[model samples]
Target: MPSLREDGAHLGSAQEPAARRGQLRLAALQEKVMLRFLIKKGTRMGLLILFAFMGFLHASIPDSGADDMEDISRFMENAGRIGRNIEIPENLHKAQGQKEAGKLLEYYQSEAFKRKYEAEIERLKGTVFKDTIDSYYGDSNGAEKDSVKGGTLPGNERIYLFISSSVPIGTLRNYARDLDRLGDPNVFMVLQGFVGGMKRVKPTMDFVRKIITEDADCDIQKNKCSAYKVKVKIDPLLFRKYGITRVPAAVYVPDVRIMDVTLSEGMEGNAKTGDHYVLHGDASLAYMLETLRRPSGRRSIDLLIEALKGGIYHEVNKR
Candidate 1:
């Protein structure tokens, strides 16, 4: 009857530990195992801390010879793989050009490289010789005849070479050649034959005048290469006055003397052997521009020579 019915059971009654010795022993064993696990974990943490400290100390100090050797070995091994056993290839250098190579070493040593490059360029320029109406006199052979016609000349100066007619294509071509050799951007070959003389002449003359006034900043972008053209009548006065006793006669003029001197002075200067600022019909356009830019009485003959040589034209009447 007691088993079949739901009788009052001792649910609150406690089972004493001393009575269950096996269970208590098992519990004690589990606690000991947990303690051992925690101790092992602490020991592992201590070893990790010790390793980290040693690594930091090693890195802070200078590397030992052994360390350097290891690094060198690694670099050499990699370099060998890349085919860089000795010095780098000639092309594959910090400075590809001689100029750059010079900079890589002593800065002063680069001067030789500069000189060599310039010398080579000069040699090439010599190869590119020009034959103009004027350059015929540059020679020693028939130079006297050409010189006789070419007046006193300077190394580099803008000269206005007045031609009566722009008709003869050959003569115009020769004149162009002269301009090429002169390396002057400033040149005025006055062509007298064009119709609407003032209409054409005014624009060209005005354009050239602007160049003489403005210097390098002349309206080049505007198709106004007017630094190089002038106008005049097709007469013997233009010839005899400029010593165009022969075709292609050139006259030289100083930047300052264009207004005062007669055109004959220009002609004489072309042939004579002496130092002069203006070449045959050459003028100091750069000098005038500089003078205007910075007022100075000091003559910039050489500088002007450079500008003329650099190719700036100066016209005759536009003086």
Candidate 2:
């Protein structure tokens, strides 16, 4: 019923709403796709960051061998400074000996002594000896026995055998006998017992003296005529410094000038430098003798045994 121009105008107006609806739908679909893409990219970025953080953690761990070496070095340095100018306790120096050496031997071999020693060693396990050297010798000068010029014999270096009163008397006897047989007068047997435990001290010294004079006819009163060499000291401080966690340990310095030593992997070159070494546990005479014979290519406990066997004192005296 309308003219052609008017009909065309009405058709254009009717199509406008449909066109707007299509445009709105297309824009909504595009926004959803963009959001999905953004989410995926963010997730990938987060995963990459997590992996990088994990890698950083892995690289920061310490090497076990290096840590052990560091501990050894620290121990050696501390051991070098023990018992400088401290006076020996009177009770320790007093010789409590028996006229009958065989009688003393019987007492040590008795079951009573065996049980006592075993129990004591067990009790001492995991017990850390306090570092009391500073308190004990505070008034004296800061001089150390290891550092003293004439403290040790010239042309005769010394091997210090540390034994706790808790150690079996038989073990002490055997160790002393072996050292005596070695015919090295430079070896010193040290007793690590309570300073004022007179009841314990008396028997310990008696046993030590008996061992010294077992095969020989020596006057205990004069502290002479015995082949065995013994020194009584109550120094938990020294034991701690040397990392002596067990009884019947041995510590020796190949050269007096070397303040410290470490038994590290591939330390053959350093072994020749006259450094200090410690052998822990109750080492048999046979084991010790064999170790002293070969002092190369070993570390930690093995190296210590080897150094002793190699006659570290004798080697140092040669230089």
Model 1, global lDDT: 0.41
Candidate closest to the true structure, highest TM-score: 2
Name the regions of candidate 1 deviating beyond 4 angstroms: 1-158, 164-187, 191-236, 255-301, 308-319
Task: Residues 1-319, candidate 2: write the lDDT tens digits.
Answer: 3223422222233446897757755766677788899999999999999999998888787667888999999888777666564567767533554445556546544678556644543432213111221221121222233223332233224456778657776787777655544434335565544434533644554554555544545564543343343333444444654566777877655543323222211123422334556666777855653454356322333533443455546646789
RMSD (Å) per prediction: 19.7, 26.8
Q: Please state the error at residue 50 of candidate 2 in Å.
A: 76
Local lDDT at 50 for model 2? 99
Off by over 4 Å in 2: 1-157, 195-204, 215-237, 258-274, 292-319
- Error in Å for residue 88 of model 2: 41
Top candidate when judged by lDDT against the true structure: 2
- Model 1's TM-score against the true structure: 0.21
**Overall lDDT per candidate, in order of appearance:** 0.41, 0.50
TM-score of every candidate relative to the true structure: 0.21, 0.34
